[model samples]
Target: MSTTTYAVLVLIGILFFVAMDLGKRDKGNDVITLISDDDDQEEHS
Candidate 1:
């Protein structure tokens, strides 16, 4: 009935859907990697 009540309800709804989406996501395949030979050269130098 109040503005605070409406805001709380909307926040709850958004968080519930976000939790569901995070649960369904992949565990490892989404990883990104950078192959930099710079690190190896730095060690030698």
Candidate 2:
């Protein structure tokens, strides 16, 4: 209806697509794998 409305709609659409993509990628693997690396103190020491 208005330029501002169209702009807001487009911004929302882009955010939705980005969230979907992140969720899809997260489903395939163990998200906690990064935590294992955090336990390795030898590397930091």
Evaluate all candidate structures by whole-model CA lDDT and list the values in order: 0.69, 0.78
Cα TM-score per model: 0.51, 0.57
* Top lDDT prediction, candidate number: 2
Scored by Cα lDDT, where does model 2 land?
A: 0.78
lDDT of 2 by residue, 1-45 (tens): 699999999999999999988986986355455555666765787
Residue-level lDDT for 45 in candidate 2: 72
Candidate 1 has its poorest 10 consecutive residues by lDDT at 27-36
User: What are the runs in model 2 whose C-alpha is more than 4 Å off?
Assistant: 28-45
TM-score of structure candidate 2: 0.57
For all predictions, the C-alpha RMSD in Å is: 6.3, 4.8
